[model samples]
Target: MNIKFSPVPVEDRERGRNGNCYNPGSPLTEGMKKQFMEEIKPICIEMERKYGVPAAFLGGQAVNESGFGLTRTGYFANNFCGLKFVGAWGRKPPQIMNGQDFGVETYQLIGQPDEAWDGSVRIIENLGEDRLIFDESSRYDNRYFKFKSKPEFFDFLCRITYLNGSEGRLYPKDLRYIFDEYRQNIQRGMSIRESCSLVACQLGKSGYCHTEEGNGTPPQRRCNYYSRVITEAMDEWNTYEWTKIALTQN
Candidate 1:
C-alpha cells in the first residue's frame, strides 16, 4: 500500500499550546513536529507497511518524548527518546594521543550494545559547532550518539524498538519496548490504539515514567502517561493528514 504521509501538516506541535509536557515557551515548537513528521515520514511508513506496528504509534513516541524535535537533549544528542548512555558508554579510560585527549567508544547504532565488539559500528565524536569528527583514538567521554541527521536518529529508534528482547534480572522486567512482543500484534493486524496500548503498557513498566500515583505532588508520577500523550499527538497528526486526504478525495 502506497501510504502518502501527507497531512496539511498542522501548526508545529511545539507552538502555542495550552498545556504541553515540558517547560512553557519551549523553542522546539509544534511547527518543528510538522517538519519532523514529513522528514521521517518515509521511515515511519516503511516501518508500518513492512511491519504492522502503526506509524502513528512510532510518531507518538517521538512527539511525546522529544516534543517532535524541539528538545535540547534529543536535538543536540540525537537521542530522540532519551535512551541513556550505559555499559561502555564512552572510552574505557579515555586516552591521550600525542598530547591530544581522546576516547573511542563502540558505536551504539547497530549490533549488540555491550562490551561485545561489533566490526561494523563506526566510532565518532561531536566536535562542537555541529561538527562530528571521526576519532577512533579519542578517550574523552562522549554522551549519547549525536545523529548526523533526523532521519538517521529516527531510524535508530525504530531499530531498537523492533530488535531488543527481554533483559535479564537486572532492572525492571518490562522496562523497555520489546519489538518481538509487538510483532505478534503486528502479525495479528492490531489497530493503532491497540499497538499504542501494548507499547505504552510496556513503556510504563520501563522508563516512560513512574506509574505510581501521588497527590499530584513533586513530579506527579504516572505510568503510561508518556505513551498516552505521545500517542494522542500522533493520532491528531494522522487526523490532519487523513483529513487532507478526505477533502482531496471528495
Candidate 2:
C-alpha cells in the first residue's frame, strides 16, 4: 500500500476564520479529502488489526475529528480524533511542537476513572504528587496529546480513547445486537459505506460509542448528528475505487 501525506494548501488554510486553517462547516473539497484519506489508509488498516475497531470507522473518525487533516490540532500537532491528554500515565508529558502547546487545556473526567488497554488509568488519581504542575491559571496542564508522528498519535488515540473496557466490553453485550443485525446486511453484499453508516447509527442509539466515560441516557440527537457526519465522510472515501480494493485486501 502506497502511503503519502498531503498538507492542506496555504490558501485553503487562510480561508478559515481566525488564525485556524480548517473549518468544519466549510471543509476541504471532496478531492482533497479523498487524498487525505488515501494517505492514512495504511494506518487505518493497522489500527483495525490491533484494536478490532473497523478501519472504515477509524477513517471516518479521522475525517470527522480533523476535517481531513486540516484542523489546527491535525495539521500542526498531528493529533487526530481530538484526543486530549488527561495525564501522562507514566509516559512523558505533552511537549511543545511547532509552536503548539500540547499541554495547555485541562480536562476533568466526566465519570469514574477508567483503565486503558494497558491498564493505565485515564485520569491520574494524584495530580500534585505525580510530578505535574498547575498552569498559570492554577489548573493542571492536561491538554491535547500531541504526537511527533502520525503513527504514534493514531496508536495512542486507539489504545487510550477507543479501547476502554467500558465501550470495548459493551461491544460483545450491548452492541452485539446491532452488530448482528448489520452482519447480515454486510454479508448480503450491502455497500461498505451504507453498512458502515447504518452500524454507526445503531451505535449512536446504544450510547456506548462515546470516547468519554459516564454512559447514561443515550444522546440520540447528538449521536445521530455524529453518525451523519461520520457516515458522510466514510461515504466520501468509499467513492474512491481503491477503497474497495484496499478494504478487501486488508
Candidate 3:
C-alpha cells in the first residue's frame, strides 16, 4: 500500500511560549510566536526546497537564542544567531549599534501623498543610512554564517541546530542525527516536491525581490530563477500561470 504524503507541515515549536524553555525575563510572546511560525515556516520551506537547509534547523536556531524571537536586542537587531561582528577598520566596536542590520526597508503602495513616505525617510535618516546596521542583515554575514554552498548549509543546519534529544557537540554528530531524521521522514514518503510558486506568491504579495548579493544590482538572472520555481509550482498546484510571459526579460 502506498503511503499518502501529508503536507500538514510540522511547524517549529515556539521555545519561549509553547515549551516554556526560555527564561521568564525573555521577551518571547504568544503573538510573536504565532507570527514567527506562520511567517517564517513558509519562507524556510521555500528556502529548503531550493537550498536544502532543513526548515526545522533554521527555525530551531531562531527559537534557541532569540527566545523564539522575544529577545529585545534580537528583535531590534535581527541578530538571530548571536553572530558577532569581527570585521574591522580594527577597534572596539561601539555598543550603540553593534549588530547586523537586516536592512528591512519599509514602503507604502499609496499614491503621492502618504504617511509611509515620511516614516520610511525618518527611519533611514535616524539610522544615518550607514548600512551594516545588524549582523544578520548583511548578505555577506548571512552567507558566511550559513553554509558555503546551499548543500553545505543544509548539512550544517541539520547537525548544528535541529534534531531532538541532543546538545553537546554542535556538528558532525548533530548533523548525523538531523540527517537521519530527514531520511526517516522521507522514507515515510514525505512531500519532497520542490515548488517555488508559493514562495513567489508570498514574495510577490510582499512586493520585494531578493538580489544575489543584496547590493541592489537589479536582481541577477539566477536570483530570478526563483520566479520559475513559483511559476512551476503554481502550474502544478492549480494549473494556473502566475506570469503571462514564459520568463521575465533578462
TM-score of each: 0.52, 0.53, 0.30
Over 1-250, each residue of candidate 1 has an lDDT whose tens digit, in order, gives 1212111112222232211222212444466667877776666665555444445566667666766665544555555665533322132332312212223222222111122233422335333332323333332222344566666655555544343323222122333345556656645867546655566666564544433352242332243565567567766777224222322333
Report the lDDT tens digits of candidate 2 across residue range 29-109. 778776877788887777655654556866887877887777666766787765545343323322321123433332221
Off by over 4 Å in 1: 1-30, 49-53, 88-142, 165-177, 186-189, 208-223, 239-250
Note the clash tally of each candidate: 15, 0, 12
Model 3 accuracy (lDDT, Cα):
0.33
lDDT score for residue 154 of model 1:
58
* Model 2 score (lDDT): 0.53
lDDT of 3 by residue, 62-118 (tens): 454455444332443344443323221122223212323532221111111111121
On TM-score, who's better, 1 or 2?
Answer: 2
Whole-model Cα lDDT of every candidate shown, in order? 0.45, 0.53, 0.33
Model 1 misses residue 144 by how many Å?
A: 2.3
Superposing all C-alpha atoms, what RMSD in Å does each candidate have to the true structure? 13.1, 11.2, 20.6
Identify the runs in model 2 with alpha carbons over 4 angstroms from their true place. 1-32, 87-142, 165-191, 202-218, 239-247
